[model samples]
Target: MPTASSVIEIPVPADQVWQLVGGFNSLPDWLPLITKSEPGEGGRVRHLTTADGGVIVERLQTFDNVARTYSYTIEQSPFPVSAYLATLQVEALTESSAKVTWSGVFTPAAGTEDAAVEALFAGVYNGGLEALRANFPA
Candidate 1:
């Protein structure tokens, strides 16, 4: 399986960041790549629509409100990967600072190279973090 992770620091309290991101269906609130996230399966699943009109469906795997963390798996997506498990977390660096990490592991599609998919997810994670950071200006 290929994996990718990205970490970013935001000049805001962890609780606040968590308040913004802890919701499974809140991606559209902060993630520019995701224009909308519609809930399904009693809110355990999310149907995401990208700004470019791409569709991705994912299911919530686990959630920890106290820990400010959540894990999810992709059920359908345009990305060339399968068995995708991803996590998003926020850690308190200080009373006024937070560190956010996004990571995932997946098997590349039959014809895709590991590095290619890794790079793709890495770019997505990194770019998404940058967009998240933009939400909290230093």
Candidate 2:
């Protein structure tokens, strides 16, 4: 399994960040790569059209308001990945500051290189974090 993680501190209360990230339905609005999202357990996310017009589907595994975390896995992906798990967590750092952690693990499908997959996931995760910063800038 290959894992990637990124952390960003947002100058906002945890509740505010939670309200945004926790509302999984609105991911496409902030995350450019997501073309559409259906919010709920077992909900799905569709990737935006890429140059190759590839498609991917991820299933919501868990959404916990108390923990301020959400988890999902790729139900259908174009990449050569046999399994994947992704999660986002929000932690209160202070009254006006919060930390967001995004991480994931993916086992490449047969004949795929783990390093390439890890790098791809790292880029996607980092981009998502950057989007959040832009959405809730200090």
Candidate 3:
């Protein structure tokens, strides 16, 4: 399995950021890769496009309000991978700022290139965090 994590400090209050990221349905507004995320425990996330212009779907595994986190597993991926799990966590650093961490682990399918997969994951994770920072600049 390969894992990647990134954090960003946003000037927005923790509640503000949480309000945006806490809801799974808001992903399409901020995430460039995700086309839409339906609101439900077992809802599906539709990808806009794959590296090869294909589509992908992921199943929601957990969305914990108390923990301020959401996770999903790739059920229909265009990539050659399996057991994909991604999560997002939010923590308040101050009244006017907060830290958001996004992380995930996945196993590339047999014969798939690990480096390429890791790079792709890192790019998407970090890019998403950057997008959030831009949306809620500190």
Give the per-residue lDDT of model 1 (tens digit) for 3-118. 99999999999999999899999999999999999999999999999999999999999999999999999999999999999999999999999999999999999998999999
Model 3 over residues 19-113: C-alpha lDDT tens digits? 88887667767777676455444445544444345666666678888778888887776777888898898888989888999988999889978
**Better model by lDDT, 1 or 2?**
1
Sequence-dependent TM-score of model 1: 0.98
Task: Give per-residue CA lDDT, model 2, range 52-137, as digits (tens).
Answer: 45666667778888989999887777777766888999999999889999999878877878888888888888988898889875
Give me the runs in candidate 2 sitting further than 4 Å from their true place.
39-53
**Residue 29 shift from truth in candidate 1, angstroms:** 0.7
- Higher-TM-score candidate of 1 and 2: 1
The superposed Cα distance between candidate 2 and the true structure at residue 21, in angstroms, equals 1.2
Worst 10 residues of 3 by lDDT: 42-51
TM-score of each: 0.98, 0.86, 0.84
lDDT of each: 0.96, 0.79, 0.77
Better of 2 and 3 by lDDT: 2
> What overall lDDT, based on C-alpha atoms, would model 3 receive against the true structure?
0.77
Could you tell which candidate, 1 or 3, scores higher by lDDT? 1
